[model samples]
Target: MHAIVLYTSKYGSTKDYAGWIAEEIGCEVRETKKTCIEDLAPYDTIILGGGLYAEVIAGASLLVKNAAALKGKKVAIFSTGITPLSYREYYDTLVLEKNFKDGIPEGFKVFNFMGKMILDELSLPHRTAIKALKKLMSGKKNPTEMEKLLIELCDADGDFTDKDAIKPLLDYIRN
Candidate 1:
């Protein structure tokens, strides 16, 4: 099957995942900025990767907005973020609700991967936002479980990407 992996990464994690997925599947990889819906016409499978920001997947509107055009293709969308996989509620509920307001389309599959969040590598605005979020959550007298997790995530400062994490996605694509 003809396939392509397209991604939009604010940091490098999503792009890295896209490359790894492409390498494993023997498909073409391109940044979303360089690709458009028309470019997707030739591929039977389209995998899109993006970094999560405020629960939104970067550049995902490319697919969400063009869902009708991609009706028959196999579509997989992945997000890279610092949230731990143990937080099933965060990933399975909050993220899905915010990203897919209209509900997930029939042929689309979603995945989430642990991503890097080195404080030193973050852009100024991101760093400031993290600091602000940490401060806000820290000041809460009785923070909710999710807020507590956010506070801890603010201090996360390393690459959490695992090459092996791509296996499930690969299995889905292959079979």
Candidate 2:
């Protein structure tokens, strides 16, 4: 089957996953900025990847806005974030709610994977935002467990990309 993976990355984490998925499926992978929705119509499978920024999936609205044109195509979305995979409730509910407001299209699947954030490599704006977020969470008198976790995650640094993490996606694509 013909497949194409499109992705956007702020810190390279999302692009890393997109490259891995393309290697597994042996299909073409392009940055979302370089590929147009109409250009993807010929592919049978479409895999999109983006990094999570403040719980927002980057460049995802492209797919959501063009949902009608992409109907019936095999669609998969993957997100790279620092949040631990154990936060399924937050990712599955809050994150999903924020991105798929109208509803996730049928036949479309979503995946979440651990990503990296090198404090030193972050752009000034990203660093400032992270610090600001931490400060805000810390100011809460009795922060929720999730808030506490976010504060901790703000300090995390390093890359956590693993080939094993791509197995589930590969299986889904192959099936």
Candidate 3:
């Protein structure tokens, strides 16, 4: 099947994942800025990835807004983030709700993968936001589970990407 991997990465994790997926699946990889919905017409399978900023998947509006045009095409969307997978509520519930307000499309599937968060590499605004978030959460004497997780995540500072994490996505595409 014809396929293409398109991605929008704030740092480099999402681009790295897109590269790996393209390498394994033998498909072209392009940045979303250089691609448009019309550019995707030739591919039967489209894999779009973006790094998570707040709860939104960066550049995902392209797919969400153009869902009608992608009908009948196999679509897989992935988000790279530092949040641990054990937080099912965060990924499955909060993330899904915020990203897909109209509900996931019929042929679309979503995946989440661990990404790097080196404090030194973060943008100035991102670093400031993290510091603010950490301070806010830490101030809560009776912080909720999510708030606690947020505080913990603020200090996370390393690459957490794993090649094995793409296996499930590859399986989906192959099938």
Candidate 4:
């Protein structure tokens, strides 16, 4: 299959996954910022990988915004975040709803993977945002389960990127 993997990564987690995916699939890998929708027209399969920040998938707008341009192609998106996988409902529901406001297009699929969030490596703004988020969540006298998860995730600091996580994405494109 003529496929290309596009990724936008801030801390290399998404880039790592994209690199692994490209290596396994034997396709070209390019950063989303360096590539455009027109550049992707030559490929039969298109894969997008992005880091998740406050439910928004970084650089995914290229795919969502240009959905019409990529019509009839095999499309798949993978999102990376520090949020734990036990919150499947949150990922499948809230995340999906926010990301795919219109709807998941035909011939498209979405995947989620654990991402790294090293406290020391975060930018000044990201570190501030995480602290603010944690404070806000901590203020709730009895936070909901989701809020609790958010609070816990804000404190997460480590590398959770795994090469095996790309298998589902690989199988989708090959099949």
Candidate 5:
């Protein structure tokens, strides 16, 4: 299939998944910033992984913006986040809508995986933003289910990357 894994990780979780996917698929792995659309022209199957922050995915614009140029290619986008896959409604609805405002491209599929959010390893700015978001959400007298999840996620501190999570994506690519 000539697939390649490209990732944009803020704290390594996305990169970890990309490495695992590449190893299993026996394809090349690279960071999105270090690559360009033209470099991917030869690859028919493209796997793009990125960390999720503030409801937005890091470095996914490259794939989304170049969807036109990728005509006929099979594109898979995986988002790594702390919100847990159990919250399918959030990923299937909220995240999908936010990231694909124009509509998902043809032959494109999206996947969500558990990601790390070690409190101590976070950067100063990211930590501060999390704290502020936590405070803001905590103040809501009647927060929605999504808001409550975000508040809880802000305090999450552990590695949630699972190698098994790559199976479905790999299977899809193989088929």
Candidate 6:
């Protein structure tokens, strides 16, 4: 099957995953910024990757916006975020709700992967945003469970990208 990987990344995590997926599938990979949905029509399968920022999947709206053109193609989406993988509710419900408002396409599959967050690598704006978010969440005298998790995630650092962690996604796409 002809396949292509398209992605948008910040801090390079999403791009890294997109590259690995393309390599594993032996297909081409392109950044969404340089490619349009119309350009992808010839491919039977498409894998879209993006980084999760403030619960939003960066650039994923393009896929939804162009869904009419992408209908009937095999679609897969993956998100790279600092959120821990164990938080299925946050990823599956919260994140999905933020990313796919009309719902994912019928044959599409979604995957989430752990991504890196280096405080130093973050731009001043992003760093300030995270700090402000943390402060807001910290002000809650009786923080909810999710608020506590957010506070902890604010301090997350280091790379969590594991090549082995991508096996399941690769297997699904290969099938």
Best by lDDT: 3
On TM-score, who's better, 2 or 4? Answer: 4
TM-score, every prediction: 0.97, 0.96, 0.97, 0.97, 0.97, 0.96
The CA root-mean-square deviation of candidate 1, after full C-alpha superposition on the true structure, stands at 0.8
Question: Against the true structure, what is every candidate's RMSD?
Answer: 0.8, 1.0, 0.8, 0.8, 0.9, 1.0
lDDT of predicted model 4: 0.92
Q: Kindly report which residue stretches of model 3 are placed more than 4 angstroms away from their true locations once superposed.
A: none
Q: Write the per-residue lDDT of candidate 6 for residues 1-175, one digit (tens) a residue.
A: 8999999997999999999889989999999889876898799898888899989887777777788888788888888999999999999899988888898867688889999999999999999999999999999999999999999999999899887888888888778
lDDT of 4 by residue, 93-154 (tens): 99898899998888789999999999999999999999999999999999999899889899
Of the pair 4 and 6, which is ahead by TM-score?
A: 4
Query: What lDDT score goes with residue 83 in model 1?
Result: 93
Q: Give a tens-digit lDDT track for model 5, residues 1-175.
A: 8999999998999999999999999999999999999999999999999999876878888999889999899999999999988888888788888888899999899989999999999999999999999999999999998899989989899999999989999999999
Give the Cα-based TM-score of candidate 6 against the true structure: 0.96
Clashing pairs in 1: none
The local lDDT score (0 to 100) that residue 147 gets in candidate 5 is 91
In model 6, the clashing pairs are: none
**Candidate 4 residue pairs in clash (backbone atoms < 3 Å):** none
* Displacement of the residue 86 alpha carbon in candidate 4, Å: 2.1
Q: Could you give candidate 2's per-residue lDDT for residues 9-116 as a string of tens digits?
A: 988888888988898789999988887788988988999988998788888878877888998888888888988888888899989999999889877888898888
Model 3, 77-121: lDDT tens digits are 999999998888999999999999999998899999999999998
The stretch of ten residues in a row with the least summed lDDT in candidate 1 is: 98-107
